[model samples]
Structure formats: C-alpha cells, structure tokens
Target: MIGSGPGGALTAWSLAKDGHSVTLIEAGPRLRRPDFGQSIGHMLASYFWDGGARTSRGNVVFPTMQVRALGGGTVFNSAICMRPLESALERWRDEHGLTEMTSEMLDPHFDAVETFLNIKAADDDILGRRNELFREACSELGWEWEHIKRFEEGCVGSGECITGCRAGAKNSLDKRGVAEVVQAGGRVYTSVHIDQLIVEHGRVRGAVGMTVDPETYERRHPVRIHAGCTIVSAGAIGTPTILRRSGLTRPAVGSALRFHPSCYIIGVFDEEVNPWFGATQGIHATEHLEKGIKLEALWATASTFSRTLPKRPKQFKRYLKRWPNMAVWDGWVSGDASVGDVRVLPGGRPDIRWQMGDADLRRLQETNALLCEMYAAVGAKEVFTGIVGLPDVMDPREAADRLREGRFERTEMPTASNHVFGGSPMGTDEERAVCDGWGQVYGIDDLYICDTGLYPSSPGVNPQLTAMALAHRLGQELPERY
Candidate 1:
C-alpha cells in the first residue's frame, strides 16, 4: 500500500484483518499528538504538501490543498463524512461504465466505515453560533439544509478540524484505521519515498526508494520491499506521478482530472458571531446539488482567513476589523465540463492543468447568487462577495441585481479545493481506463489503484466516505485472488 489516506489505510486494515502481511509505505513523516500544537504554521509545515502552498493553473489558478502526513488528507480535512449521492453513482454507471459502483452494492461498505469511524450527525448542542446563523438563512431562503455528519468520538467543537485535531475527537485514519492495521501486525514505514514499482515479467515484485529524514532533509539509505500484491493509493496527484515515472504511459493514467471548484462568502451581522467558536463545519445544503452545486460553512481559522483575505494591506485590514461580525460560507460546483490532465514534471512532481469549462463557470455564478441571497436573507447588514468586480452589498435587493448582472471572470475570485478526483480511472472499458472494474491496472499483474483517482468523474460532494467504501469493497474482494 503506497499511501495512508482513507483509501490506503482502510485497504491496509482490511487486508491485515484477512491475515495478509501488509507493508504501508508513506512518503511523509508521522506526527502524533505529541508533535502537534495549535500553531497553523507548524500544522502546515508538519502535515500539508508544499506547506499548503501548492497551486494549480489553466483557465483559473487555485490552491490545491493536498496533505503530506502519515494519514494524508485524513489528518487535515474537516472529517466530513458523506456517502456518494445516488445521482453521481448513476452518472458513473451510465457515462463511465462503472456498472457495479451502485449505492445498493456499496451499502455494506459504507455502513462498516461509518460504524468504525463513529460517524454521526452534528446536533444542536455542538452546532455553534455560526451554524445557527447558516441554518436560519437556509430556512428563510426555503432551501433544505442538513447537519453534516463527522467521524468523531469525544468532539468538543474545538474549531480546529482543518489543521489536525489534537483534541482526539476527529477519527483521522492515523488514529483509527492505521492504528488498527498496526495492531493487526501490519508494518508502517513513514518518511520514506517510493520512487517506482519494480515490474518483472509483467508483475509487480516490489518497489524502491530512499529514506530521507523530513526534518533534516538528509538522504539516509536506499530501500526496497517485495510484496505479493501492490496497490497504489498515493492519491490523484502522487499515484499518477509514480505510474508515469515507472513508464505506465496510457492516456487515462494521467487524464480525466476533476474537482469541485469553490469560493467563499462572508457576511457581517450587528452581533458578533465569533465564527471561530465551534465545530469547523457541521452544516451544509444539497438543495441545489442537481445543478452540480453545494453550500457549506468554512472551517475558518485565523491563518486560513488571513490567506483568503484581499491582497491589498488596506482592504485586508478592513476585513480584519470586521472579523468579529463576519460569518463565512463555502460553495462548490462539480467540474463536470472541466476535464484536466496531470502531467509528471521533469523532477517527478505532478503538474495539474485545468480550467473551468463554461458549465462550471456558470455554476460558479449561480453559486454566487445563492450565497449572496443567503447572506441577504440572514439579515446581514454588510456582505462581502469575495469577488473582485463586485463591491460590498448593503441592500438585499441590490445584491440580487448585481448577482444577476455579474460577469464572473476567473481572475476576480480566490479559489481553493481539497477534493481532487481522477487521474487513473477504473472501468470495464479496457481502452479508455487504466484499471478494470476490480481496480486492477491493465497489463500490470498484481498491481491495482484503490483511491478516488479511480473515480471517472467528480462525486460533487465530500468523497472520503465514498472512497473508503469503494476501497473496502475491492480490498475484501481482491484478497480471494491472492
């Protein structure tokens, strides 16, 4: 297993439970509770890829927030657990020929993950003031909203879910699944890079890479491990880079990249919302999802909020002054029309090239309209659209008019995405996909990809639960062959 995110960790846990010997190799260092603190700077340095600085470009430039820790994204994500919507599964079946990835077939896997992770809906007791405002706005706007479920145990609403929770609340893979794997006799190698798979006689025998200390940047020694079967869960970016570097050059191996491109909306009310008090995010709406759009509250922290603020010192300081009154919401549209490719740079790093297609752009505008309306509906006295051409709206009626007339340009808004799906897709069609219905890579014996990269299209929602479910289904089924 070449990763430790939900897909990789869950697969490892399952395989180990089946009495299989597993060696989980992670390129990043392991940080436990002792190494963690409240500093966002330390969190980024210790957990995130490029210290949370990597960005992608094409039609629009945006930060791609991938993690580089023992547990990968499970370490820094908000722990939002959502099963794949049935509508998205239908698209995967009809368009991508993923016939068996139906909701009914994967129900057991989802149930297993939810039970293991202790997933539960956020209750009113923990929903914080920010959520109260958001829920009220959704109600007033006549949009159906729901409390988001999270993988948590003793959660105290620390509001630091994004930067690695030290409260021992969020059930990140490192604390849950990965720990179980270790308990089941699986070995883990952290801070060791896997350069490429060793293919011999059309079969994966092992992999080779060097051990480098993440703290000192010192190359220690080259290492190799031989395994009976190989699975790549290095995520959408890392997996493709590894395959291409190892000479797997099928077109689908690095194509069909998709994302739920997103922006934020901040509204200021007379009373202090103290937006940083409770759970990072516990509320969201799927009312407009058929249009490939969704809205949720952001996991706002001081460091993240400052980063999303205006570039200008004066304009930025102004927002800081009003920070107490500010309540932020997030919006995203599944980039259905926006297909992209991940290319291996000369140094083995992945370069993602993507631009929002017309559909995605329109979706963004529609999201802006909905978000602006929500803020207006909530009796916000001042609303900041986070848009360049648009000014602060003081009147709800004017906000609606401007939203309708607004011509959204890519340059005007800041965007960030944690959900990057697809690079090597899996399906029954051998020619267009790199992996089969079983997630086995074509022409590569004993090697498979078990991650969201296997997704032929974006699921348009939080994908961790879906990825875990699919990985569990395949992991349990594939061991019989081994």
Candidate 2:
C-alpha cells in the first residue's frame, strides 16, 4: 500500500484486519501532536505536498493543496463528512461501467466508517457567529442549511481544522485508521517515497523508491520491496504521477482531472464576528444546488483571507483593519468540460494544468451574487468580493447586476479546489478510463488504485468521505477478485 491518507489508511486497515501483511509507505514525516500549531504556514511547510505552494502550470494558476503527511488530507481537512450524492454517482454507474458502486450498496460501509471515525454533527452550543449568520440567512432565503457531520467527538471549536487539529478532537486517519492498522501489526513507513511500480512478468510485484530524510527532505536509503499485490492509494495528485512515471500510455492515466473550483466573499458586520472560534465549515447551503453551486461558512488567517482581498497594498490593508468583523462565505461550483491534466514533470514530480470554461465562471459569478444577497439579508455593513475589476459590493442589488454582466476575465479570478478527482478514473471504457470497476489498472495485473483518482467525475461536495467509501469498496471486493 502506498500513501496514508483517508483512502490509503482505510484500505490498509481493512487489509490488515483480513490478515494481509501490509506495508503502508507515506511520502511525509510522522508528525506528533506537539508539532501542530495555529500557524498555517508552519502546517503547510511541515505536512503538505511541496510545502503547499504548488500551482498549476497554465493560465488557470491556483494553489493545489495536498497534504503528504501520515494521514494525507485527513490530517489537514475540515473533517466534513458527506456521502456521495446518489444523483451524481448514478451517472458514473450508467456511463462509466461502475456497477460496483451505489449509494445503497455502500450504506453499510458508510455507516462503518462513520462509527470508526466517531462522526457527529456539531451541536448548536459549539457554533459561532458565522454559523449563526449562515443559518439565519439560509432560513430567511428558505434554503436548506444544516450542521455538517464531522469526525470529531469532543471538538472545542478551535477553528484550526485546515491548519491541523491541536486539540486532538479530530479523528484524522493517524488517530483512527492508521493507528488501528499499526495496532493490528501492519507496518507504516513515514518519509518513504515510492516512485514506481515494479512490474515483473506482466504483473506488479511491489514498488521502489528511497527513504527521505525528515529534516532536509533529501533521498536517503534506497528501498525495494516485493509483495503479493500493490495498491496505489496515493492521493489524486500523487496517484497520477505514479502512473505516468511507470510509462503508462493510457491517456486517462494523467488526464480528465475534475475539481470543485471555489471562490470567496466576506461580510463585514457591526459587531466583532471573530469568525475564527468554530469549525472551519460547520454550516452550509446545499439544498438549492440546481447549478452545482454550494456555499459554506468559512474563516481563515490573514494569508488565506488575503487571497480574496484587493491586490493593492493600500486597499488590502484597509480590509485588514476590519478583519475582526469579517466573516467569509466560500462558494464553489463544478469545473466545466474544459478538463485539466496532471502530468509527470522532470524528476517525476506532478505538474497540473487547468482552464475553466466560460459557463463555469458564470455559474461562480451567480453564486457570488447569491452570497451577497445572503449577507445583505443578514444586515452586513459591507460585502467584499474577489472579482478582478470589482472589490467591494456595498449594495446587494448592484452586486447582483454587475456580477451577472461583469467583465470577469477568468484568468484574473483566483480559484482553488479541495476536491480534486478523476485523473485515473474507473470504467471498462479503454479511451476514457485507466482502471476497471474494481480499481484494477487496465492491462496491469496485481496493481490497483484505491483513491479519489478513481472517481469518474467530481462529486461536487466534500470528498474525504467519498474517497474512504470507495476505498472500502475496493478493500472488500479485491480479496474476492484475487
């Protein structure tokens, strides 16, 4: 097993439970609780892939965050738990020959994962002003808003979910799945990088790479192992790079990337909102997602908050003064048909390229306007948007009108995605899929993938739960197949 994220961790734990000797190789260091802090930069530098500064190499330049630590994204995410939408997964079943996946079929697996992670909805007492504002706005708009489930049992509402949980309330893979795997006699190797799959006699035997030094990140000891089977459970970014480096010519091995490109808007209130005292995203609007537009209450540090601020120093500082009262709403929509790709660059690193279609950009604009209306309804003093030419939208109606017909050159809009999937999609179709229904790489026996990269398309929601569910499906079925 390669990678120790959600999909990787769950798959490893299940395999170990079935008496399969598994060696989980993670490309990052094993960080203990004391290593984490409120410093986002410190978290990124220590636990993230490429120090969290990686960007796509094209016109649609944006930060592509990927955690390379012991638990992968489970270590850094907001712990939001969401099942795959039946409406979206059904499309994959019909088009991608994914008969193994269905919401009904995965109900037990979802329940099991929820139990293992101790998933629970945040109670009203733990909610902050931002959550209250979102709930009130959703009620006024008659849009559905609910307490999102989190893998936290006794959360203290630290508002540092993205940075790394210091309170130890979060059930990240290291504390749950990986810990169980270790207790079950499974071996997990941190700071070990697996570069290529070792194909022997037309079958994957194992993998080879080098152990990286935790301090300098320099390749240390060479590594080679032989196993009965190899599952590439690396993340969406890491999995595709492995396939390309192994000389897989299938176009789908490193193409057809999908993401939920996100934008943000801030609401300035009369009272100090201090939006950094609760979960990163405790309340959300998903009921009226006819166009795949989702809204969630969000707050971040000055660096993260600066992403949507005006570029000019003077203008940016002006908003910084009112940061105490600023509460942000993160809006996201599905990426359009203008697909993206992740190719292996020199030295076997992944390079991303993406461009959003005009329709998708327009949908994001519409969502932005809708958030403005919500903030206005809640009596916000000011609405600050990240639109290129426009900064602050003081009037809700004017914001709606201008966003509907604004000259938003998509290149200028800063966009990022938490849910990146579909580089190595699952299907029987040769042209569009890199693997079969059970995550068996086409034409490569004994090699499989159990990660978000197997997603045929973006689920348009939180993908951590979806990734684990799919990995669980693979773990249950692969034993039978082989």
Please provide, for model 1 over 405-434, each residue's C-alpha lDDT reduced to its tens digit, 9 standing for 90 to 100: 877777776677889888888877878888
Scanning candidate 1 in windows of ten residues, the lowest lDDT window is 391-400
lDDT of 2 by residue, 1-482 (tens): 99999889999987787777778999888877888888888888877778888777655776778988889898888898888777777778898878867878888889888888899888787778888888899998889888989998788887888887888889999889999889889999999999998887789899999999886689999999788889998888889898788877577887788788888888888888888877778898887565688888885566677666566889778878878787888888867455788998798889888778887777778888888888878888777786777754466556767787776877756677777888888887978898887788888789988888888886767788987877776777777866
Candidate 1 Cα errors over 4 Å, as ranges: 216-218, 307-319, 392-397
TM-score for each predicted model, relative to the true structure: 0.96, 0.96
In angstroms, the error of model 2 at 50 is 1.7
Clashing pairs in 2: none
